[model samples]
Target: MRWISKPLPNNDVVNSLSKSLGIDRVLAQLLALRGINTFDEAKSFFRPNLAELHNPFLMKGMEQAVQRIFTAIENNENIMVYGDYDVDGTTAVALMSTYLLTLYPNVVTYIPDRYAEGYGISYQGIDFADDNEITLIIALDCGIKAIDKVAYAKEKNIDFIICDHHRPGDTVPDAVAVLDPKQVDCHYPYDELSGCGVGFKLIQAIAETLEHPFETLIPYLDLLAVSIAADIVPMDGENRILAYHGLKLINSNPRPGIKAILEQVQKTELTITDVVFIIAPRINAAGRMKQGIHAVELLTEQNISLAKKFASEIDQYNADRKELDKKITDEALQQIRENNEEQNSTSVVFCETWHKGVIGIVASRLIENYYRPTLVFTKSGDKLAASARSVKGFDVYNALEACAEHIEQFGGHKYAAGLTLLPENYHAFKNAFEKVVKETLTEEQKTPEISIDAEVDLSYLTPKFYRILSQFAPFGPANMKPVFKATALRDNGYGKRIGKVEHEDDLPEHLRLNIIYGADDKTYNAIGFGMGHQLDEIQQAETFEAAFTLEENNWNGFTSLQLMLKDVKC
Candidate 1:
């Protein structure tokens, strides 16, 4: 792993901030590196305020969307809340549909099938709306690229209000409103909201128009928090505020569906990472293994009993997903070896019978082996569908755009995307993609780089410092858990490989170490997951540098500080 330490702020600024905030110089330097230099900036970073949120009307098309919803409610017209099949989409659908149902009786929700209708606003979904006499459709997490589908809906007298955050094409869908901050024309203060965040803004606008306080919508932020974290959007700006409050709700007064999912977990407080692993997969499993409507049902269900039943079914789906995800990932790796494509700049593999829902995850797993742009293709009807994932400093969406001539359709962000192509064009597209990336990718881009925020001796660590770091809640992209580099680490003779899962075949997949820094008498416990391979190298050196993040571990009813090592080097 390439350890890249971020340049620290100058001593003058760090000293000033430390004096102003009455914090350790190290803590103040961390804030300064994130651009929180002034007293108010630090204050806002620690205590996010809803009033700091951008005005809902500041978005280009938000007013139009609000007016359209008002018209639907006034005339008692049928309104269908449509969303994609992923967690971001389903959560938006749940949030919007539930809020609408509270105000009007003609509201319903819809989630397209990944196998049948594929991604985005599907013609089948529009047909269902037409057959049911629904004249208004609010599409969440999709429809920005549905120019054709939106036009088809328009011919049938169904208007569309799109709440999306994806990059727009040359021309956007001719909807009544397109609330995507990524659009070149949009001037919303922060343009990095998730699909669910956009959906929340629409509801916020509606509430304001109805003379309701902003607190009226606070209950829905738990859904917003999960969507933001799972979708991997930035945690800076308004997103941080939403996540901050949403986490509070998650720990204090979560919805029935969320509470049902948390019933068996024993964590006193769950972080954003916990939500991504424990909650998101279960919600996403409903859409991946079956239909996302089940997710919406779980989130919107009023009765605790019914919510638990839905949660139980979704849990089974997650179990099934994990099995398929693992099996398919192994198969994709084997395909790469058989084809002898290990040295290629891209990893493109396919299977005719692979489960379509797990292709995206398989693409991610492939990257651990290849460390480059990857695409995992699976048969979708007559055509082949693929999920694209890219490394940092690489734009997979732009790379896909370069090969768009061979693609039937594609849409997503810079890091991840989805696409489909003809079966005959598979080999050609794969070759073309590899060529494009080989000519364009820089040498430094291929190696996995671990960015370190600061280099500090272990002696500087204190319980007081950890307490201040814990306030950096709701960490995600742009604002992440600060990574530190510690050198001169010597094991306290208890360091060894450990395994707790049977699937690991009793072979250690993790390293548990009790180590002292330099001549310090204190020792710290550290665990490095998937880093058992480093034991041989570490034993040779016996003293090396480690890049890690500070964490609190609770075991056997006792809590203590632990370093979550990201990488170790000799």
Candidate 2:
């Protein structure tokens, strides 16, 4: 893997801030690398007070969207909350619908089926709303590019207010208000909100118009936090403030759905990483294994018993999802080997009858081996649906747009996207997509790169240092946990034999490891996961270097720091 070091900022400025903040020079340097250099900026970075959140009216078209919603509520018009089928979509629906239900009773929610209706706003949803005498639809997480779909709904006397975060087309949709920050005309200072965040801003605006304090929306931030984490949005600016407060609620008093799910886990305080690994997969399982509506039910359920029931069902769905994901991933890998597709400029694999629900996970898995722009497709009803995942520096959405002639519909961010096409056009689209990637991509873009925050001496590693780092909680895309690289590492003479431990008889020899790292003239014990295979190599080598992150591990009523080795070189 390529190791890319971010350029450090001015050392004098960082040192001054470090002295003022009472933090390490290295930590201050990293903060300055992220453009936080002043005392005020450092305060905002570490504290993340809700007062730092941008005004809801700062977002383009937010006033119009809120005004339209208030008008619908005053008129007693039937309103539908529409969203996508992923965690972001479902969470947005739950947050907006529940908040609206508090103010008006005519609100309902609609999530299109991933298998049948594909992604984004659906004609079936609009038709259903029309039949039910719904006059207004507030779309969350999607509808930025539904130009014709918006026009069609308008023709049916249905007004739409889009609160989305996706990139808009050249011509904006003719909806009542388009609230995408990507719009050229939009002046929202922060542009990296998740779909649910956009929905939250809408509610914030509505609350402001009614002369209500923003704290009135604090309870709803739990859903926003889940969506922000699940959708992998950048945690910075307003997003950082929202996620910081939201996680406080999650730890102090989570909603019934989150509480029920956390009962089976062992974390005392939930961070964004915990939300991504523990909560996101469960919420996503609903869309992958059953329907997106189940996720909304779990998120919005008020009763403990009902929420537990939904959580249990979602746990089962997640199990089923895991098994299917493994099977399809193995099959996709076999196809790559059999056809020698791994050597191609791009990777596109199709299975006629493969489970449509797990292709996205399979596509992500293929990246570990093939490391290319990959697409995994399966037959969905009369069409072919696929999930596209791209390597760094490659915009999968733009590539898909290049091949839009053969695509029926597609939308997503730079790294990940989803698309559908007529079954007859699959071959043509695949070829065209590969051609685009081959023509535009560079050799460096194809290989995986691990970004290292900085190199530091092991002497700098201490519990106090960790305590300072811990303040950078709720880490996600933008404010990722710092990774450090160390060189001239020597393993101690002590090494454990590879064998089954007391409780794990089924584990293979390659799954065990017991090693030590020499730092500051002392040896520290370290346990490595899935690193036993490297035991012989490390033993044979005289010296080595490694990249890792410091993690606090608890065992037998004791807590201490350990190096979580990511990679090693001899």
Candidate 3:
């Protein structure tokens, strides 16, 4: 693995901020790297305020969307809240549909099936709305590129208000209003909102028109936080403020569904990482394994008993999802080796029997071993559907766009995407994608790299320093948790390969260590998952360099600082 140190911030700015804030220079430098150079900026970063959120009306389509909703309510029209069958989409549906139910009684939610109806807006979904006499459809987390689908809905006299974050096509759909900030005509100050964030903006606008106090909307932020965390949106600007307050709500008083899931885990205090791993997966499992409407049901349910029952069923779905994810991942890896494609610039593997629900997870797993742009395809009806994941610095969306001739439809962000093609075109598309990646990929982009924020001595790590560092909560893209590098580190002889093997034939996958730095005589506990193979290398080396993030470990009612090891080089 390549270890890259981030460029040091300007010394003058760093020193000035350190003196102004009365903070350690390392903390100031970290803040400066995150664009928090001024004391006021630092205050906002550490204590995000909801008052700092942008005005919802500033969005280009806000007025139209608000007017459309007002018209629906005034006319007593039956409205359908439509969303993609994913965590972000389902949470947005829950937030919007629940809020609307308070103002009007003719609102319902729809989550299309992953098997019968594909991603984004679908004709089948529109037909369902038509049959049900739903006149208005508020689509969240999708519809940016649903020109044909939107046209189809318009013919049925169903108005659409799209709240999405994905990039738009050459021509947008003829909807009542499209609320994506990615539009070139849109001048909304922040553009990196998650799909649920866009949905929140629409509600914020309606509340403003009704002169409702902003505090009344605070209860809905819990859903926003889940969406922001699960969708992997950047944690800065408006998103940071929303997530900060939302996390507070989640820990202090979560909704019944969230509370039910939390009761199953043993964490007293949860972080953004905990939400991503614990709550988001259970919520997503409903969509992935069975039906997304189940997730929405749980999120909106008021009865604690029913919520718990729903949570239990979703947990079973998650267990099934995990098994399928692992099985498909192993098969994909074997296929890579057997097909002699291990050396290729991209991984493109397919199996007709692979589960459609877990192909995206398998695509990510394939990257762990092959460490390149990867795609996993499974049969979806008569066509073929695939999930694509790319390494850092590579835009898989653009790469797929280059091979668009072979694609029937595709849309996604820089790092992840989805595509569909005719079964006969799979081989041509795979070869074209491999060629596009080979010609575009740079030498450094081929290998995964660890970015270290700074080099610090172990002696400098005090409780006060850790306290300041912990304020960098809710970390994500552009504002990640700081990774520190320490050199001349030696592990005590007690270091061992940890974690139990499922079977006698399997090997342990984790490493545990008591690490010492440069004869300091102070040992710090460290654990590295999937680093068992490096135990012998670290034991043989006199000293090694390690890249890690500081975290608090709790065990048997005792809490202590520990290093979450990312990589170690001897």
Candidate 4:
């Protein structure tokens, strides 16, 4: 792992921000480095107001979508809310379908099955709408790339309104409204909204048309926040405001479904990270391990008792998913070794028996060991389906496009993608993908690198400083928890590996540290997870550099500031 320090802001500007904001110089410098140089910018960054959100009508297709929905309501025609199967899709489906039902009772919800029906706007889903006499489909988080499927729905006299955030192909679907901001001509204020965010914007526009105030939609943001966190969209611009308010709702007055999901868990307040770990996975489990209908059922259920029942089922699904994921991941790792492919620039492993739902996750796990682009494949029906994941600064989507000749179907963003192909094409596609990434990927891109925000002394790790830093809540892309570097750190000679202590050998898998550095007499304790390989080097060195984030560790009911090591250089 490489530690890369970002360029620091100029001293004069940092000092100016420090004086104006009445904050510590280091805090001001951090803000300046993140482009919050002005006091007003800082104010907006800290206090994200709903009033600052972009007008829903400003999106290119929002007006058309609202008009179509109003027409459907006026005609009393059935409207089906369609979405993908994952968290963003399920949550967006719940948000849009439930919100529509409040104004009109003819609305229904549809989710394409991950197994029976692959992804996006499925023909089976359209057939369901036609059988039910549904005239319009409001497709969320998908349909941007379903040009042919949209045409098929059009032939059935069903109009489509696509609310998606994926990158558009050369031609978009023939829908009444395409709300993807990634479209070349469409200009929404922020292009980085999650699918749920786009769905919220559609409802916000509908609310305006119905003469309802904006605050009427506040209850829906919890879904939006969970989608934003799980989908891993950039948390800046309008997204920040939505997540900020959504978190407030989650903590204070979450809906019965959300409240029921959290009934067994104990947490005073939940952050975005917590939502990703605790909430998103369970909601996603419904689709991954079973049919996605359970997820929409859970999110849309109104009664607490019924919601708890749905949550219980979803929880069990998550447990099943975890087990399947672990089993598949271990098998994939073993496959890499059996094939003698560990030295390759990419990890391409396949097993006919591996579960399709967990292949995406296994791809991510492979990156931890191989530290490069990875693809995990499994048998899907008669063909082969694979999930592709990339290291930082690499575009797996582009690489897939380069190997398009052997691909049956592929769609996704820069870092992650999904594709399928014939069993015969698997080896050729794998070779092509590896060749493309190897020739195009930079040396630094292949190596895992941590971006360090600043270099500070151990003395600066004070309660007051940490208090200010903690205000950097709800961290995500563009705004992340700051990491600082401290040089010339000599161990107090009592550091030892901690985890799996029963081994009692050189490789204990974790290390506990006691260090004093920079003329500071205070010895701070640090834990380096998975850093047991560096124990011999650290023991030989008199002084070394440690890159870390400041975290408060609670041990035996006592809380103390500790160094969360990112990396160490001797």
Best by TM-score: 3
The Cα error of candidate 2 at residue 306, in Å, is 0.5
Tell me the tens digit of each residue's lDDT in model 4 across 1-570. Answer: 788889989888888888988888889888887888788998898888999999999899888899999999999999999999999999999999999989989988999999899888899999999899999999999999899998999999999999999889899999999999888998777899999999999999999888999989999999999999899888789988999899999999998888887885766678888899999999989989998889999988889999999989999999999999888888889999999989898999989998888899889988988899999998998999999999999999999999999999988778889999999999999899889988999989978898999888788789888887877767888888898999989988888877776454545888789887766468998988988778878989989999898888878999889998879999
Which regions in candidate 1 have their CA more than 4 angstroms from the true location? 266-268, 501-506
In model 1, residue pairs whose N, Cα or C atoms come closer than 3 Å (at least 3 residues apart or on different chains), thus clashing, are: none
**Residue-wise lDDT of candidate 3 within 445-554, one digit each (tens)?**
99889999989998778888999999988898889999999998988899998999999988799999999875557899999999999999999999999999999887
Query: How does candidate 2 score on lDDT?
Result: 0.86
Per-residue lDDT of model 1, residues 1-570, tens digit only = 688888878889899999999998889989998888899999999999999998899999999999999999889899999999999999999999999988999998999998888888999999999999999999999988899999999999999999999888889989999999999989998999999999999999999999999989999999999999999998999999999999999999999999999985656579999999999999999988999899999999989999999999999999999999999999998998999988889999999999999889889888987899999999988899999999989999999999999999987778899999999999889999999999989989989999999988887777888989989877999899999999888777778888776774567789998878766458899999999878777877868899999998989999888999999888
Ranking by TM-score: 3, 1, 4, 2
How far out, in Å, is residue 349 in model 1? 1.1
Show where candidate 3 strays beyond 4 Å.
none
List the candidates' TM-scores in order. Answer: 0.97, 0.93, 0.97, 0.95
User: Which one is best on lDDT?
Assistant: 3
Query: lDDT of each structure?
Result: 0.92, 0.86, 0.93, 0.90
Ranking by lDDT: 3, 1, 4, 2
lDDT score of model 3?
Answer: 0.93
The residue pairs that clash in candidate 4, if any, are none
Q: Poorest 10 consecutive residues of model 4 by lDDT?
A: 498-507
* Segments of candidate 4 deviating more than 4 angstroms: 500-508, 518-520, 555-557
